[model samples]
Target: MQIQDLPYPDPGVPDARSGPRFLWWLFRNQLGGQVRSLAWGLVHFLSVSALPFCVGYAVQAVVDRSGTRLALAGGLLALACAGNAIGDTFLHRAAITNWITAAARVQQLLARKAATLGSALTRRVAAGEVVAVSTGDVEKIGWFVEAVSRFTAAALTILFVCVGLVVYQPSLGVVVAVGLPVLALAVLPLLPRATRRADFQREKAGRATELASDTVAGLRVLRGIGGEELFLDRYRSASQEVRHAAVRSARMWSLISAIQVLLPGLLLIAVVWHGVGLAREGRISVGELVTVYSSVMVMTYPLRHFEEIAMAYSFSRPSARRAARVLSLRRATSEDGSQAGTAPKGDLYDPATGLLAPTGRFTAVVCGDPDAAGRLAERLGGHPSSTEEEPSVLLGGVPLDELPLSAARTAVLVQDKDPVLLSGTLRELLDVPASGDVDAREALTAAQCEDVLAALVQGSLGAEDPLDARITERGRSLSGGQRQRLALARSLFTDPEVLVLDEPTSAVDSHTEARVAEGVRELRAGRTTVVFTSSPLLLDRADRVVLVHEGEVVAVGVHRDLVHKEPRYRAVVTRETEPEPEEPHDLQELEELEEIEETA
Candidate 1:
């Protein structure tokens, strides 16, 4: 898969059984790229290794004063140089292709997973951790995958060089072969410590990242409450912890690097010492001695691959583990293996709470606890609740879980209490993937969003339309009420069959709230609309009101009737007591003054 063809047609399900297995799966998927990289890498390293042999032959030709041999050696050197250049270029190309494709594959998997889990993803994984995995962690995994092929080529080149040396000169070849393995394995004992430090550093870094994200998201709130400095200090402490862990990790890796360098130098010295003795005993020629020395020096470059591979594995192990954790999460309904059947076409019902929103009617649900109300709204839209078994909500008479995900979402739309406004122009925000005929202007009017439109027009340049005005991320520039109204307008524009709103008017003033209630009632006259709120104005407008207490429906009736009949319902809708009337003396004095004025 090339980078241009990215966002692969089928990213395919990942083997998320474990970190190592996931890495292996990625490697297997990109086998073609990996093979190309390995092939080119071998060519490059082999050409590099053959250079010493060519140079060694040229030196012998010069010593023997043979022009023919000298010409042959020169030709061989040119061939080796040409091969090295071509191989190096292609190797680089193949390696980069592998890296980009692997990272793209991982990104696709993450995107698919995020879509499947939806909002539940944030509850299962931190927003910061998810960001980290999709961004930096994916690159690290790709780096490991790309490095594996190069490391394999390096090892193979080294082995081939050793075999060539043994055939040319057994005495020095044995010494070189034996010493290379020692150099490579010398740092194995330190890897465990290095890996532990890397894991700790990564953990601290993830926490710091999460803290920073949270701080930025709540910056306005922090400033309002005068808690910005506290959060800053907390982030500072977290960053310091990450720094210390990284330093400790670097120290261990540095020690391993030292061992790698020191051991190779020692091996080079041992090979030279043994080769000189063989030369003195007339067992090896000067050219042979130079070849052995150059080969050992060349081996140093390949030996570093050991350290590179080790470092890659150490960093990628935790990243792969994190990616696996996210991919392993499945929807609650899918986990239990029960097919609830397709979303039925009718009223929305939550069996768990015994609350029913009838078709073509406006229903208001009042709950004492806001959280319970939100969960109920979610359940009504077919979202699973953690506390419930067989967490399925029915649409018409069909269980929501039984329907296809797209069909279910299309049938019932749930607007959360704090709905997100994606960064876009007003027009784009309302351009949702809706199935029914919806007019954006009508929805905006119904949502009481005139003020929002005026604000947008005022913020824009001359002659620019308000609908074309750009909104900042999460609509942070807009007031809470404006954001809420805009969100409601967007939801309305979807024109879903069943619309569930949780405290849709909580952020607006009473006057605006009443207008929104009336508008919603008028616009959704023949559709199911469920509003989870205790606002008296909104409740009084609903055709039917249900009181949900402690997760069950405790009372059902008109808002005015319930207010007088149920104290619990009355207490929630009207928290304060009513004042008494004026005294009898005050009433008699006002009547006598009115009679006197009339006589005069």
Candidate 2:
């Protein structure tokens, strides 16, 4: 495959049972490639095993009485070396190819799963965890997968060497055959502790990554509230924890490396000592002794691979489990299975709040608690808007969960108060995904975005087309009101069957806000539109306003009608209208709500 076509692997199963299983499943699927690589590796390794024998033959010939025989043995040794070099080159390349492709496949699976789960993925798994899994974890899995072939090649070569030694010198061969097993199995006792340490280190690293992501995403708000220091301190603590875990993990690995080295060295020494004795007793010739020594020495190469495979697996198994958990997440709850792609053919209803938004009407949800109002809007659009409760939101008499994700999203579009201002031009921001189908000009007019268009034409830095002018990330360059208007324009452009707007005009001036409220009512005359706002101007425009108090709709009517009939609704809206000091009682809570709006 070409470099550009390299597939990104995304194996999202992160649970304990799923990690190894995912690898196994992938192995089964790619068994043919693996088998081909394995066959090549075996041939390469077998050819490589002839080097020590050739060296022994050359040594014996030089020690004996002939010049021509010595030259012939030397030539054979050179041929063996050349053969080994060629075999090793192809073996390494084939192994690496398998590793890279496997990693790419895993990454692809993960990306697919992330898209399938979308917003829900973050709600369940931390953003950092996903990032780490897609990057570092996948590489580790690939290492382990590739290590399998290396370990197999090493084991087979070692066995061949040991058997050859036994034929050359029975006494030394027996010593080697028995000692190799000891070196391979000796590290078993320490493996459990090493695996545990590696797992702990990985967990801390994931946490540190998550903390950094959160810090960066909230850097703007954190700076606004002067909480950067607090978050920085938290991040420092997380980093320190990761450092400690890494150090512990390093210590374990260092110890294992030492054992791997010492055990092989000791075995070599014992085998040599036994071979020397056999040679002195006249049971073995000098060339045979050299052959025995050479065989044991060559065996060290394979043993090292054995240890490497163990270490690779020690880290990868847990990482695979984490990836498995993410992939295993079902796209949607099965309870909503029957309702998917089917509609109830009536108005939408929320069971928890006892709020009903009739189909094809301009309804306003006025909540005394802004949090409650935001949550209500989320439920109406099929997102879990409640923290402690899963409110039931129905569309056309059918539950939102019952509708397929696409159907639900198409039927009801919740334009959050603070719409996400992606890095693009004002035109692109307003274009949205459905711009081609909807009338962009009409939507812009309804959203009162004439100023936005003027700014794009006059102030944009690049691209002559106003629609093509690029905006900065999060639209930080634009005023809050401009961003809100652009988001409103985008939502209106969708022309969804049900349009839910949460505090849609929070950043605009009263006059502009009045125009937007009126424009929205005029544009969505027959469609189901729910506006979550307490602005008297917007509320007055609502055909009917449902007053939400303590998570329940206590009163329902027009703005003036509710102010007269519901005392709590009047107080809440009045409080919001009144100007207060910069330090609001629930300042943090209010800021979070604003941030949520910005994300819409």
Candidate 3:
């Protein structure tokens, strides 16, 4: 599958409210399990509430001078504690299990969507954003999902306590009922700011992650150009920004936490003060007031949860939005075309440009702009380029866009100038998909990789089997020419009906590149191949060459013929030979051309 055909997402401006909506979607889908989790949580919470009741009972029993009743109350208290412990253990385990499984499922779905969207995914979203979603964001989403039942149980417990208090002691109960809402709702004003700060923190974190990834990826280039220190300084600056954002986020959460603690304490003081006045007036008994005090203290636990839920939601909402954005990307599929599994017989036709790459022929396309050639290669390989007009690229007579991805891939392949070589053995490096049972010997010979194999052999103890020798990541262990030949050999082994190579030997010397052109022709005989290159040797070898100037084909002929016939083609192929404004002598121009050609 080509990368450009991978699904791309069009995530509009992310709504702050999307987090709640996402949670609701998850909740609805897992309602049965959620209900069970909530039920267990409630049982556990109610069992806990028994502690306060037992204290209230024991106080009354002692006041009444009933030893037997006091003993029974203590026993009841022990039983309630045991039940709460058991229930809480199971409750936590069940809830956490649900959260993990749900998160895993969502991540899997996102990964599948990403694969379908292919290269388009990276085009729309930063690599770091995708990384964050899979790692950090997924876990945050899970926490929010599991927090649901716990939060619900806490809310219910609060409601139950308020009603019970009112029934037991009407005056104290009224204050307790009124104050609980104040504790729960007091943090509302700070929530918006906290969430905004959290979002900023997450965004900065993602950017830092992206910067780090980019820096690591180009570390070799950066070092070669003496720009490593410059990048390091930039990264340090980005880190400082992240640190500041985190501090702001932490401050907001801390303020919410302070209110969570202070407000409840203030409510407790108010309840105790009012309860004592009523007791002095003979409206309520001492034991009842003690019960009221115990209840208010217990109420602190649930109020603490209010603060916890707020903080968790604040952090997790942005994460969920990020994950949602990734998930929402649609895989690239043809909108209007036949879904035929069959491939066209010969040649590739770009209807938009009226260009044809004839079957079983070596066609050289010379674009005035290198970028234009790259775009054309991308389109020919059944993928979209960043061209303003969405044009159809046809393989044989059938539109490439119309064919199923598998068919399109089998029939056409585009080898980019710089292709990725994953870390593995030499054999694995040349083992292209669908090229089954192709020994390393045949492919190495075809791409003239004898030097590459010899290098692998001389480097290590396990030298007899060069294919088994380990390749460093990105083939950094090998020279540029060796890497290019290995990539070319891998592509040759695939033996696609139509092979499109974009400057396959751009990094190699003339000797190796000329050999590669010869090897490519010998190995891919009677197969349609289009090479986008300005190399004299490769162009000379083409059966028919097409020179594209300013996005249109201006001349069609062999390399020597075009060099003699087309001035633009000559200037491009021998760019280094062209007399510079500063040095216009023919002798100097010839010297420069010889030097450039000799270097190549």
Best-fitting candidate, measured by TM-score?
Answer: 1
TM for candidate 1 is 0.92
Question: Model 2 off-target regions past 4 Å?
Answer: 1-17, 64-93, 331-346, 384-392, 416-436, 448-460, 476-481, 576-600
Worst 10 residues of 1 by lDDT: 333-342
Give all TM-scores, in the order shown.
Answer: 0.92, 0.83, 0.84
lDDT of each: 0.88, 0.78, 0.79
lDDT of 1: 0.88
Q: Where does model 1 exceed 4 Å of error?
A: 333-343, 385-387, 576-600
Q: Model 1 over residues 5-76: C-alpha lDDT tens digits?
A: 888988888999999999999999999999999999999999999998988888888888989998999999
After superposition on all C-alphas, the RMSD of every candidate to the true structure, in Å, is: 8.3, 8.6, 7.5
Ranked by TM-score, the better of candidates 1 and 2 is 1
Candidate scoring better on lDDT of 1 and 3? 1
Q: What C-alpha root-mean-square deviation, in Å, does candidate 1 show against the real structure?
A: 8.3
* Candidate 3, superposed: residue stretches over 4 Å from native: 1-23, 285-287, 331-340, 385-387, 424-432, 435-441, 448-468, 576-600
lDDT of 3 at 258: 88
Candidate 3 — what's its lDDT?
Answer: 0.79
In model 1, residue pairs whose N, Cα or C atoms come closer than 3 Å (at least 3 residues apart or on different chains), thus clashing, are 341-402
